[model samples]
Target: MDVRFRYSDHLVGLIEDAAVAATRIATAPVSSLAAEALRAKRDAGRLSARLDASPLDDATADAVDAGSWARPAEERWLDEAAGEGWLGEPAGRRLDEALGGRVTGEPAGDAAAAQPADGWATALKLDGMPTQQVAAVEYANLLACYDAESELTDQLFEAPMTVLTTLHGLICRGLVAAEILGRPRRTIQAVHDGAQGRVIFNTPDPRVVPRLLDGLVDWLGATGPAGSAGLPTLVVAGVVHERLLEWQPFEAGNGRLARAAARLVLRARGLDPAAVAVPERTLAADPGGYHNEVAATVHRRGDLGPWLEW
Candidate 1:
């Protein structure tokens, strides 16, 4: 007997209803709503990527290498920024001020005075842990790194690896959180053992990877016009996240990779990539729903609305 389930229509209707409800709420400024949505998308993407255990295809591999290869020069500039106190201690103080003393202990009397002005700089190191926790830490670390730097160019080269690694981590974290597997890293292994829906899309083909990276870079570099122009940013992030999942890229970490890539895009577009203070944590709290949303998109050939709405 062959059995198949159809949940796309049901899920899409539910998402549309929620979006309608949100639209009816107190009129939210377009810029503000776009910013928040971008952040949430990034968070979800990071979580998803960190959990998958897939490997990189040749195209993706080249992109990752190119991005990483480009980093040394940027790193030197970053080091200079740090040395000039542009992105070092002074920047830290500025961040604290901008965060409204959230980073520091005192209130910043004005937004302008709080603007990290130079740039935000931070270094994050995650200790070893079982695969799942590692995934979460990776996502958390990426958020920290992205938030620290004010200029996207500084992270241009490292973007691909950052995206892939973070995605791997998030998937692991999600599996552990859901108790779908006792060990975080072992979720893929367990799935394989059970023959429970093979990841179905794991490869390092040279054909698709480069296109993905280039598309991501182009989106990051594209500019928006004045007054409430964050829609493009959110749309690009949503597209990238969905695309990576559709590509599958790795044997086990595709979901996590997609999420991490989304976070990178958000940060590159000058948006906060952290999930800590936003609605993302609330969304992630429901692992089953989160997985279902992603699955819906993947199965539907990347329809995006259901995943993006959730």
Candidate 2:
């Protein structure tokens, strides 16, 4: 059996659904925060364009590469809050630590981490293998999509799916590097696993996939402004994510796609989607409970309060 075809079919369904949702949301009203976020996004876009057009000095390039365009506004806001004593000292300290020594620069040790930090290098030596190459390819693809100006309908499904593929690929590579999975077994198992599942959410009929996705897109676009007002963009994004996950749309990778969709919504809201301010990681800490929450929602076909609250 050709597992590639199965994987492709599953992904096609998922992509179609996502594309439809994005289209709906694209026409929705822009929330106040979304407006602010749009401005920031525009600024970042302009900066990126300028960088691409003209070469910069190493220092300047380094700063931009460190994501300065995205950092300054948030950093300043946090600094002001801390300066006013609005943020507790401990909280400020923790933030600083997480951000590394410089609030405006790349996190501390990222450079070293990129090139085998001391302990990591020692581990590699002991294992008699090369240092782990953190998957830069995935990051590159994400950055490319972020920089693109295409409409949601044009790239929605592709962007998120690319991210998912990159994520899984990175995970597999990391596992192999750690000697948890040998190369040959990795190749065979990944192919088999990717191809085997046909568990699509909501409807089994492939034809419904495109229509469902389009409905979501229309809904999102229509409600964009109104949705932005009553709820924080992050919360709205979370809602959308949960809804899609419940709908399932694809046989495999629904969870990953939902998470990616959440990230996209966050970006649309003008926030760093990857920022870990929310305790989402905490929910993932208990894997079984997390799955149960999702299962409950799927079974009940109603409120996802449990999952959302977590």
Candidate 3:
């Protein structure tokens, strides 16, 4: 069944206000601050991604031994897809570059030089080179996100599973085992409220995830092409964010994926085409409030009115 969601009069008004703002933003002329604002927004996104990986602490949750995690997943499909020129030229090039050293079966550049005692530490800065080697998986995530943004065409929106899996594969490349990359989580998953130190909720059985995702795709279809039509941009963005989080489709990197997907919705929908607005900035500012709102929405059985308003 499609997840339940309710719309209120207040929610409708809020969406309308957001729509008006989106129109103004879409029509506004480029300003000197656009570049700077975009840069700031990107930085915020990176920080938010890091925080999502490690909500309560700066320590990396997905960190593994450098030896085990250093070698990229040498998947044949990746190279084959790259050779087939899938998802356009830029995306293909990025895919090739992401698997460059591994595909050649030789160390390349700094990845060769940085011989740490342990495995790579992804999600943030490597404070000490002696202990933590930078993971190429992180670089893959950067390229993947950039490519996803560029490839957000109507066709992509029509069948978004490709982009979603690509994002998951790149984001969780070395951080997880190769077999699980681009795969829906098979095991049970539980998310805890870091601040409260209590289990907020447990994800549904993995068997149902595919069905839930299909429902999400259907909802996206109703939202229209590029996920920008029919509904207000912010409403679409919010639903995308919450549903992904609620589903917990991947074993890891779900938080980052959710945020990234929401950003794509915003950009594709013209709410933040210039990427000036930093939703993460506000989210990171009020971590407690953010968690509370999400928890509240989930507790309400996916009634997203409060979440959209928030």
Per candidate, the number of residue pairs that clash is 35, 21, 4
Query: Worst ten-residue run, lDDT, model 3?
Result: 103-112
RMSD (Cα, Å) of candidate 3?
9.9
Q: Who is ahead in lDDT, 1 or 2? A: 1
lDDT (Cα) of model 3 = 0.59
Arrange candidates by TM-score, descending. Answer: 3, 1, 2
- In terms of TM-score, which candidate is strongest? 3
Question: Candidate 1 lDDT, tens digit per residue, 204-301?
Answer: 23234445444544554444431112344455556666665554433334454455556555555444333222333554477455555656665675
Per-residue error at 256 for model 2, in Å? 2.1
The better candidate by TM-score, 1 or 2, is 1
Lowest lDDT block of 10, candidate 1: 180-189
- Candidate 2 Cα deviation (angstroms), residue 214: 2.0
Top-down lDDT ranking: 3, 1, 2
Off-target runs (Cα >4 Å) in candidate 2 are: 1-205, 224-230, 250-252, 271-280
TM-score against truth, every candidate: 0.39, 0.36, 0.69
Among residues 3 or more apart in sequence or in different chains, the pairs in candidate 3 whose N, CA or C atoms overlap within 3 Å are 65-119, 66-118, 66-119, 66-120
Ten contiguous residues minimizing lDDT sum, candidate 2: 182-191
Best by lDDT: 3
Candidate 3 lDDT score at position 33 = 48
Better of 1 and 3 by lDDT: 3
